[model samples]
Target chain A: MSPLSLTHRDTVAGPVLLVAGELDFVHAAELRRQVEGLVLHAGQCLVLDLSGVEFCDSTGITALLAARQHALAAEAEIVLAAVPAHLERILTIVGLVQVFTLRATAEDT
Target chain B: MGCARRVPADLNASPGPTTGPGLRSAPGAGDAGAPVGETWRHAPYPVLVADRRGVLTGLNEAARQYLPRAARGDRLRDLAPSWLAEAHHRLAEARSPGGGDVPAGHLGDRFFEAHPTPAGDGRVVWWLIDRTDALQAETALHSARTRSEMLSGIASTLLSTLNVPRCMEVTASLAAQHLAEGAVLIAPPQGRRHQLTYAARGTGAVQVTQQVDTRSVPGLAEALQGFPPVPARWLNPDDIPDWLIPEGFTGPVGSVIVTPLPGHGVPAGALVLLRSGTEKAFTEGEEAFARLFAARAGAALSAARLYAEQSAITATLMRELLPPKLGSVHGVEYAGNYRAATDQERIGGDFYDVHPGSDPSRETLVVLGDVAGKGLDAAVLTGKIRNTLQALLPLADDHQRVLSLLNGALLSSHQTRFATLVLASVRRGDEGVHLRLTSGGHLPPLIIRADGTVEEAPTHGTLVGALPQVRARTIETVLAPGEICLLYTDGITEARGGPLGEELFGEERLRRALAGCAGMPAEAVVEHVQMLAFQWLRSGGHDDMAVVAIGAARSGGPPTVAGAKDGMNL
Candidate 1:
């Protein structure tokens, strides 16, 4: 039920976006817009720190995939840092556990 | 009717009491206090005595004060108001009083009705009585009547329809013909564009939509935003933008009024009225009346807008949310039922469709799914998913490939939604019936045997549309006569109800219900399952629940099973 908030921070891993709150139908497009607006050079890594994701639905899953697609099109690497436990189970249920690079924490990226 | 040229007797009657004869040089030698003819000299009302030649002979003290220019021997034309002098000439020539309106005119700032009485020596005594207050009262009464009639007409005409465009048209026309020489109605801007309905006196309104700079007109942008309008006097007529002028209107604007149309809670729109330079400038009273009119129009327009919006949503619901009817396919009986989450929530994420194959030999495809979210958005996506599945019927035998293709289609589209789907391909032959069931993150279908036991198919996969790939395992099973295979969405098991109104109608309850319906017909099986789930949630919680049962009709001969059931929940 929490509203979504996104914050961008430049890190050694390149650009890291801290995403908090529910990533459902209403807020998924906002997340996609934020990701698409980022300038990712080749070989740079874009990390999504989802440590605060409260609720993730199928639309939220699609948004994550769209972000990954955007990064790949820029020839940049994408990673999910600090994935919430429920979101991890969701990713596994959709057979997407092996698709993206995962890190234990944003600092690990 | 009285002759127009006749002067009525009342016009001849002296406006005041005639000089009392008793006062004229003592009627009985000692009864009078004034001398002979002194009453004419001291009449209380203005009295002018003019001869047939239109030359003033004498005047009373009141006349001197009322007509300051009058001299003892001056001509009536040079001393008195022209209307009075003209009346004196006309009345002096007539011997008897005629029948017609009396002459009236303005003398300085005061209004008067002049009465005449015959005097000796071919002269007329003119009495001027002030009637300024009476005339003003009558005029005000007439203007008030006219305004009330117009307001009532506006009310009836505005309430006549719920069509927004028609209402706007009427608003523009009424304001143009009644309130001003021309009118321009600006609807609330949608995005950066504005819709304008323009009307001129004696012309039908025309509508145009374009991006307009609201700031071009003074007080326009604020008025459009529901702010109170600035006084019309503050507006400079020359500053009006070209777009503001009604088409074909070829007159200079004398005055302009921009006012907000107050609606329910929010402003409906803004109204602009234009007056030609030849016409009188708008008055403060007129501006206040315009606001009253704008209020009525605003209420009606907003109501119409709301009605339009609601109907559009309903149309979408009717076209896409209603589940399709299921019937017998080939030799198998197919029946399905759907229920929305609540009365207000007529549509939710749950949806299902059964597509009969091109031929009797080909398997009929049944797809059931639940999209993310609920209501209108989810129902819309459900429609797309069903369409995609129908297009991939040729690949029904390969459930994994069908899901992957659908995934690609959904991902490529602009919708940010995904769905879980279970596809069932059915083929009937000399054997009872064959069904290949596949689950794409949807719960596996439950099979009912003639022996009254329920077995869950060993099939599961990732949901379609959201993931980069789809992986599913398809299980083949055969239904021996009078056996049913039930496919349903999560709404059935996820319904929160029972004692505390928080308990879920879980899978165990569903499996038990199916076992009780073993050996039943397809229609009966689905009805029984749905009825139980619906009853369990009678305490209140519900979601969009759907159940599709594909059953093989019982035969006269012994049943031949194509293969034994492969999966079991136990």
Candidate 2:
């Protein structure tokens, strides 16, 4: 069980949250809290950078959906940047790929 | 003249000795019928008599010491350069018939109250009294009130949430905003040490520990010892540990207050508050307030830690209760899924397993059963039954004998628990896949023919576990290529709640559901039935559901039985 590490930075676009390690049940709530604290305005974007993510589970997927919902509620945009291949497969299987914007890197967003 | 004294030509002459409470009289001036002029000259308070022209006419000993440069006839403007202009304006107001006492004013650092009284012959008396001590007391009272209000705010914010990480986040945010310029909460090491540093941002706080050291910091060690808040001031950069400094933090931290957060029996962690250059050091009052805040945070952390531990334990047990993955078996397509009726923390008694036989016949044994109860008790019984069946798998050829042995084992245990289970033995020969099923008070298996026909397999037996001896009969059938069989728990057929809101998803309804699933793969067959059952039970209650579907290999497909082994002694 690899421990999760979260780091965040503010950019002209909005806030970008970087997640690493295994994003599973144990550390899903922490990511949720960090994302929930973000204050977004219309036309701003919140990007989740997951290039370093080693693994993700159903709970992790749920947290990502929650982040999307929060951004939508705030009338803002959300993008998943650098998502690992395995997580993308799961997202596609669960039919959530259509609901989120994907980018190859944070710079791309 | 009738006057007791005349004005002296030389005003600088020393005149009087103090000899009264309000007025000090000169040594000989205390005599009976002493002149009123001598008494007024030695008054204890500063007294200045200015004529209607605002010129100083007379002043006592106290006035000379307090003002230092005034002569009897000097103008008020020449003596007190800073205050005389304001005094002249105030004097004009005082001479008015309706004028009141002047408000207090500062003379240098000291405060004073000025009282003016009208006198005859164009002379006015002014008295000045010091008020420095009273002003100091008022300022101190106001500061104490502000500190306490901040303490209350910190307490309410820390105690508002019970989540452990959120509690720590709030603590860091509030401490940084109200108590210090930078704050870090060092949680008790979880596998490895890490710090959560929150620095004050515009209206919120940001986490800044991207590359922190995992080792315990110096102050944190002392804090974990359970001492009170320890204040460190004028600390050199070397004195501060590497873990406490956030990556890219450029500000110099001059001081810090580190306090222990005591949990149920031990300290949960430590909270470190940092201040930069020129910020006032932590006062005793603030340290007391920090302790109050940490106490509330400690309780919330302890509760959350305990909950996490219990959840971990439940997850471990559930993993144990879950049936092993149903791997591919020879000549059959196997798929199954189970959903517990309760939350994730609980284990349901609904279980199923497929064990291939060890003999040359290559027969495979499949079992699906539900214990009589729910929760831990049922789970324990299910484990026992599964273990016993694993030991009895060598007898797979004699289905009735294996069940009779299971029945005897349960009765001999003297336990009140019972179970309903279906046991099937499957083998492949030149004809097709052969299946023999035996039911011990369990539901009959549903067989779907390749031609879209669905019907219950003809198998029936007595219930197990209550009687000393039991009898069960076996029904054998051959599934041609593309045909499938499904065995399920009562949770499916007995489920209630449909369009009518009170009807059971009876066996007839299950048959109707399978009618449309012909020629489908085994996995899709199980999914279709499970989905229909779920839809029927929507808006109502359900029990645990478990299903296992076995299909014969298609005719043209390569044989799935090559090198296949037997019985997974589960």
Candidate 3:
């Protein structure tokens, strides 16, 4: 179980939050807090880069949804970039692919 | 003559004018006439007339009685030595006609205020008024305020922690810091003769628990009788109780205040505060403050004790509710695992039992069940169902009869609660191994064949405990070798999670996962499925899950038990 690491960079669209490692119960809250602390402007898009996430649990999924809700409440947009295959399968199974905008990579965003 | 007159020894007893004929009237003294002089002679307060050079010119009777040796021509500083210097300064200022009265001062133990006025001939008349009672009242009020503040501090500090031992430590340390030098808090003995004691010396607190017969401590037993605080003045070492003295304590304790900590209607413990050095016996005000603090500590201790006791009971009950370890059964590999929802206590409605057959057939009976709800209520129902099934083990050959009987028992005793269960009877013969499975509205058992094919055994029935009678069906199958049958509760298939948490890991996914476990052992099959479902839920927030796997040993030389090869994976 690799420890979760978070990094961020500013872009013209908004800020890109890069998440890596396992996103289970113990580490999900950390990501949630980090995403919630982001300052976004209306019409801006927040990109969540999950290319490095090796595993994700239900708590991690809930955290991502919470980020989407936060973005919606702020009248902004949120996108998932570089989702892994297993996680993408889960997202498709739960029918959340339509809720979040997905991109192949951060460069695409 | 310039000789000063001495005051009479019985001045208070005489109650008469103090003026004597030894003095001659000065020129222009008639301006302040004899009538005014007579008024000054009998005044209640001390009155004195002084010249510019600090010489006393006249004195009143009250002044003579208070000072005992004051007369004309005596320096005013010689009498009332503490206040005369300040009075002289005030008198000089008074001569300017706009100066205010002098501030109050003390003479011996008596407090006094002075009023100086020009006497029309360069002399100043000083009147002294006592203010002892007002000062004492202020001092008392200040002490009371300090005591109440200390009480609030101790209350907040002790009540902040719910941990029993930590609360004791805080109580002792706070008492020492605010109220006394040495503090001791003794909790009532729980079950034994030993009492929990926390003692503080200076700022450091130490726990010194000692078991002592309650009869040995005289005043302590009485203090524990739930009375108001008992104060004791210890004049000597013998005055201290033999049993109450803490080890390594060697200082002179002047007084002890012992108060009962009454909790809810009973006594929780006793708090003992010891004042050392020159501190006097516990005053009324201090005792009241101690009682207030003890009330708060008592309530907190009572609550903490109750919480500790409840936790212990819950732990014991959980241990009993947990499924027993599955023992090795001949000719079959068996493994079982149970995991409750993350938010619930470890005890849940999910339960599994393996009862070996005692009849001629040598069949082993296995039961997996899930009650309708969770928590203690559901756990109790699960226990009843398991016990009833165990009693019906003799009917293992007839699955319908056993389940039908269980349904009747549930309908008669617990009509509101319902359960879903699966019963499996496994036996060995020359042919190979035989299995008769019965499902009481439970998910059908999945059989993973040696050829890596997964099939659901044909078993269906009505849910038990819901109706007067259950129409259960028994399905029979044979495992040649290296085949496993998995029984699980709905917690596996109905687990909700994934992207939007709207997805369920239904029977399709379960069948697919089982297809991969063709030659795997029983324990491995159970572990794989359990892990997969856990990963599907992600947060592990699904309902209680219980799985039991029974696999026929693959035929080679000899068959190996499932957990024997690799220990239980549960």
Best by lDDT: 1
Which structure among the candidates has the greatest TM-score?
Answer: 3
lDDT of 3 by residue, B1-570 (tens): 011122223321233232221111332232433322445656577877787778888888777767777778888667766456555755565554233333457766676656554556677666665556655766788788887777777777777777888887787777666666667777787666545564545546677567766555446666676766566445464665656654444566677877888887878888777776566667777777778778888888887777788889888877778897774465577889998765557778889987765432467888998886667888888888988998888777888898889989998887436777899988765565689998886778999988888999888776677556667778899877788999998788867786666577877899999999999988899999999888899763677889999888775422344323442222
For each of the candidates, the C-alpha root-mean-square deviation to the true structure, in angstroms, is 15.4, 24.1, 16.0
Judged by lDDT relative to the true structure, which candidate is superior, 1 or 2?
Answer: 1
lDDT measured at residue A69 in model 3 versus the true structure, 0 to 100: 71
Q: Taking the tens digit of each residue's C-alpha lDDT, what string does model 2 give over B1-570?
A: 011112123311324332111221333222423222445576677777776677888888877777777787787766744353355545555654223334356655566555454454545556655546655665667777876787677767766666667777787777777777777777776544354646542334444334454234556676765666566445675677765754434477777777888888888778887776567777776767667767766777777777777878877876778876764566567788787766653467788888865542678899998776566767877888898999998887888888889989987883435577899888766676789998876778899998889978777665566445556678999888878889998778757789987676877889888888888878888889899999999877567788899888675432443355443311
Regarding TM-score, does 2 or 3 come out ahead?
A: 3
Docking class of 3: incorrect
For candidate 1, write residues B221-329 as lDDT tens digits: 8988889876675356679988999985767777899988877788888999998888888898789889889999999999989999999988776667678888765
Q: Where does candidate 1 chain B have its weakest 10-residue lDDT segment? A: B561-570
Give the candidate number with the greatest DockQ.
Answer: 1
**lDDT, candidate 3, residue B293?**
78
